[model samples]
Target chain A: MSAPGGVLVIAQAEGGALSELSREMLALARRLADETGGMVEAVLLGENLGDSAGDLIAFGADRIHIGDGAAYTAYLAEAWMPKLIEVAADAPPAVILIGHDTMGADLAPRLAIRLGTTVATACVEAEFVAGRLHATRSCYGGAARETLSFKTGPCVLTIKSKSQAALDRNNGRKGEIVPLAADAVQTRVRIVERNVSAAAGVRLETAAVVVAGGRGLNGPEGFKVARELADLLGGALGASRVACDLEWCPASIQIGLSGRTVAPELYLALGISGASQHMAGCGGAKTIVAINNDPTAQIFKSSRFGIVGDCQEILPPLIDALRVLRDAKDS
Target chain B: MHIAVCVKQIQDPEMPTALLRVDADTNKMMLTSSVSPVISPFDEQAVEAALRIRDALGEARITVLTLGAEPARQVLKAALSLGADEGVLLSDPAFQDPDSYTTALALSAAIGKLGDVDLVLTGRQAADFDAGVVGCGIAELLDIPAITFARDISVDGGTIRVQRVIENGHEIVEVASPALVTISHEIGAPRKASLRETMRAARKPIAVWSVEDLALEAAQTGALGARRVLEALYIPSRDIECEFQQGASAREMAQNLARRLYQANIL
Candidate 1:
């Protein structure tokens, strides 16, 4: 853990390709490395990662450690932890960057414990301050931001998704690709089944516009108005934690502190009270429009425009008007 | 079977953002009297998950544990009222303002002191800090398997099965005893405590433990044991001026709003 080394990015492959967050991590690592005069390295562990290794280099990785096998396909921390440690041993990293997703949250702290290094999770901003890693993360359910620095080196970090900008692909970039030392390790935990819930349209994270429903909608059926608005806008539909907790919407689309964080161009909040936890997810939107009957609702505080009326009373006409505007623009 | 569920009490996360203020001196949120404290919502769900395990086994011991100030005992009482068998509060002057690492260190020591915990349950992330690392840290310190974001959990014989929520969907994972599983919101709402249980909880004796009780050194319990240092803490300011559209009717208002969005080039 004390060896002089560069930043290490752990790349996660989704659907046989490098995930967006992985690329973002590489970009952030590149920035940190450039500032500190260190090389940028990444570990890509999965089957058929030949192309992704190149993508990782193109995204700013100076070296790619490949663990290409079926055993690396599933995200079993017990299996991958040993491999990550092996990589770190070969080239001890000053900073280890991971995507602050499910896999990262599951692995970072454990890796820190094993490596005897400090770790930070869900960090939005990370920089090298006086040769130490300083990371800023949203806390207090996103009501405040806290900046923390490690007391020592080799800090493990889980970077929040969509916080860092990914560098443009540069096919001309060259990096080293080496095979990791293979080992057979026994894992006590097993993933028996994986069920992929069918997503309807544009993904919530990448959607340009998002229409979200909340408790003000009252029940499951009220989401139809939200769906119609999203459809008209050609965007994605989202929900508050309450909506998802009540089973009115899938938890996958819950936008809140414990759920997905979205930064769409336009966020249309329907009947949402804009609790701090919920705002933690959608606060990054360029523009937020809220429709809640309660004038004192918290959502209005963060919104650019607000309509203080019952969503049920105003939504149908609003949808109709938006549809008409769309049709007019189309014709 | 023995189950330990770790919970935390914090200023209600659902409190209005306007009330949130940072104490520059301490680099922490100013706990205002205007905001009443509540058990972290996800930790409540963790208590619920433990109760379900007890119900499934029909004869299992569930102990609710919390590491905070004395006020944290309130959360333990709430859990006890909801049917947990025992309550343990790790409270001491030396335990104040520990980072995630130290927090986990102290909690793991307490778990070891508990002596025979077969399984551990905790919220996916505390509603306040949202660190989501203590459960795994405890597992790491105890050298046990940890499964996170568990939506559903059940016990069968000596193994524990969990439906872990992932980015796309869920993955059903199984592990043997001596494991830690972090509960998620998909576990559904926790059951309410009955009036009789509430009264009974009022009389229940809570076991309070200190750093010495867990055999943890003061240096390894709080700020001294902290792995990371907080440099700054402050609320991010937002200044979006909201414009309300005026109209003779709801439809007119909707029309005006749409046109305004287009004019602003946001649509």
Candidate 2:
């Protein structure tokens, strides 16, 4: 086998467009490849990758490998892994990057085992030094960060969402497009049902502004105020792990170490003490505004602005004030 | 039916950040008395998942396996108290501080030693290291299929059905027997051990296995076998100075905060 050199990103598509995380991986791959002196390549796998190959090149991919078929749309490690190995046979990549989403959490480790290697999972930072990958990941429920380096090359990594910036599209750049057949592999796993419980308003993972509530809300009714605030701001509603555990909110919207990770431009944390675990999910927000009655809460330390008061008392007036501002801007 | 559930005992993840102390020299958290050890929350849920299956079947044997130090037996005992039929403690000096790869190797070896395990279950990830790889690694080593991030699970004849959590929603997946499933926090809280069961668990004899017992090489079972090298571990220091929104009353403070956000262009 040839020695691994370039970086490979496994691109994912949602609603017929390249997923935000797929683009983020391309951005990171570009930076890493530029620094390490290797080509930036991507593998697009789906039923109909239509124009995604061109998009991949525009996003800094030097080459795009397409695996188009019905089997590629829904990810089952059994079917996708062999296809990936077959695609990489032409030019093996030193590092394979996947977004640390549901598919990644299932695929990376198994793929590493198949390749007789190891994976650095959910990495927030990574760089190539001395021909090896050094990755930094959070552990101890996000209370601490651990930096690790692989002993050998040809490793896999699942990058945390929103951890890196996507480069601006440059249509003028040129790249190669290679198509590969979807090999037949017997897969034991079958997706019997796919449920998309549609929620109103913006999606939490990509929302620019996020409004999160915690146990300090006193009861489930508190979420009514939070939902109204989120809808008024055209944002999304989120909850801490405790609130979800207490059944005050659906677990689908929980934001914490064990839950969803959201990186918004502005994060308003209401009635939350900001445990390290909870902060892990939203620490990437550009601006954090915290409101808790406890002046010394941990959230205050991470917040750019804090208000020490009861959320119940502050939220109503805050909503009114936001309404006034929105009306003024509209006029 | 024979089921094997893997569990781990670690410092309570819910402990306050002030109590979390890291030893720079060792690259490990300082295990102070203030922070008590408990079963990793998700692993406890895994145990619950196994018990739920056993309850539905009316006749099934569940075995709890844990690879850690002697004290790690507490997690096994906790599982036994929750109605696991047996407990196996995989412990050895060589097993100390193993990475995810070595840990998976040792656990899979132990499972092989069990001779007949129709199904395997584990938490999505341990709260401490959060590597989230052992379950899949075990599946690979055993040459079986794995469905991860399972929020719900049920069995029919020789097939296992799992409701897996995806990005926007959930997907129901089905695989044949001898497969593995990693339980997520969405599985709901685990049941508490009763006082009588706890007493019984205290008296239950747990089988202990060493590296040699599992036929694993000393060089391939612990830190010596770890494929990943830890360069550093530390808490990220935060120095953001928070400016408090001030006003004469709650309503006024809300208004001022709104105006401040607008001025800062954050709204």
Q: Write model 2 residue lDDT over B1-267, tens digit each, in one string.
A: 899999999998888877878898998889979767999999999999999998888878889999999899888988999988899999999998888899899999999999899999999999888989999999999998999999999998999999999866899999999999999999998999998888887777789999999999889978899888999999887649998999999999999898889888888
* Residue pairs with backbone overlap in model 1: none
Candidate 2 lDDT, A132-154, residue by residue in tens: 67899998777789999986556
Chain B alone, candidate 1, TM-score of 0.96
DockQ of each: 0.76, 0.78
Error of 2 at A30 (Å): 1.3
> Per-residue CA lDDT of candidate 1, range B66-116, in tens?
999888888999899998889999999999889888889989999999999
| TM-score for chain A, prediction 2 | 0.94
Model 1 per-residue lDDT tens digits across residues A114-225: 8876688999999877766789999988888989998766888999888988999999999998887555579999889999887888999889999999999988888987
Candidate 2 wrongly placed segments (more than 4 Å): A1-4, A329-331
